[model samples]
Target: MNAPTGKELEQARSSAQENHRALHRRISRLSDDAIDLILRDARSHYAWKDQPIADSVLHELYDITINGPTSMNTLPARFVFVKTPEGKARLAKSLKPQNVPKMMGAPVTAIIAHDMDFWKELPFLFPHEDRRHLFDGNPEYCADTAYRNGTLQGAYFMIAARALGLDVGAMSGFSNAIVDEEFFAGTTLKSNFLCNIGYADETALFQKLPRFPFDKVCSFA
Candidate 1:
């Protein structure tokens, strides 16, 4: 597909803002199917059908996810889509025994990582002040910020994919060190987690797990 023109981009942004305002008015909620597709009925898939995710879908997923909010707009999340056989092989070296088959079978496995030097872009992302200096020599602060925002982005990614009719299986059962060495070598990026994406096999899914009620997990101030 052709890249969107400046006018098209502006139009899309305007449309999105209109939708955002509509949501706040309580005049409407998303259609049941749409809600199910993205949340209530979505499951953490472990098995996939023999279908492939298109490159365009991956691009669109990122486009949608990048719009999600980040702390100080420090969008530190980076993704490496492992779709090819060679790419999967490289990823397999870091997978745990229980996760190996799942990774090998999925159409794509995304290596969600965070850039340690993301604050360097604060001049453009946070522009109002010179925020980059805050992390210039503070390794601990930079690491904490990167991991925090990067994990949020990873969740955004999964939501975006589900909204686009894809299933997601997010896993943390792997070696971050091995993934960083294999995929992020020579870069300041460090692995956060892995997610398998594709069409899920409904028959292969386990029973739905229960969640805590709102009152049990929350408190009013």
Candidate 2:
């Protein structure tokens, strides 16, 4: 797809700002359809249409999701978009049997991971102070923080994809060891999960399952 024109970008920014204000000011609740598009009625799709997503849209998805919060803005998440047959073949060896077809059918699958040495970039991402020293010698702390923030970023990725008119199917049933060997051989990164992205095949959707009520999962502190 072609890049958005300057005028189009400005219009999109203005519309987004207006929507943000409206949402915060309670001028209007999100339309039910809009809510359904992103959350209320979203589903974990197992089947996908043959349509391909544009590179520009994939870039936009990352641009939007990168703004999500992280501890000390550590921003540990790293993504590998596996789209080609060769890439999918490499990933296939790591996937569970039931997840194989889903990954192979989708147009793209994201290998979401975290950099264990994320603190090395603190000088740039968290420039206020020398926070690198905090995790310099602490392997346990670094691992925990990387995994936690990386997983959060993966959630942001799914949300961003949904907002941009795509469907998502996130799964954890993969062999981390094989994936790491195949993809992160020389890097300090470790796999957290995999998420498939594409247009959904609505006819293949399973029935929506029930969710826990607020009273059952929340507390009045």
- Once fitted onto the true fold, the runs of candidate 2 whose alpha carbons sit more than 4 angstroms away are 1-29
- Over 82-148, each residue of candidate 1 has an lDDT whose tens digit, in order, gives 9999999999999889999899899999999999999988877875566787899999999999999
CA displacement after TM-score superposition, residue 7 of candidate 1 (Å): 21
Pairs with backbone N, CA or C atoms under 3 Å apart (clashes), candidate 1: none
lDDT of 1 at 221: 88
**Per-residue accuracy of model 2 over 3-114 as CA lDDT, tens digit each:** 3457887897799999889888985577888889889989999999999999999999999999999999999999999999999999999999999999999999999999
Clashing pairs counted in every model: 0, 0
Q: Work out the TM-score per prediction.
A: 0.88, 0.87
Residue 199, model 1: lDDT of: 94
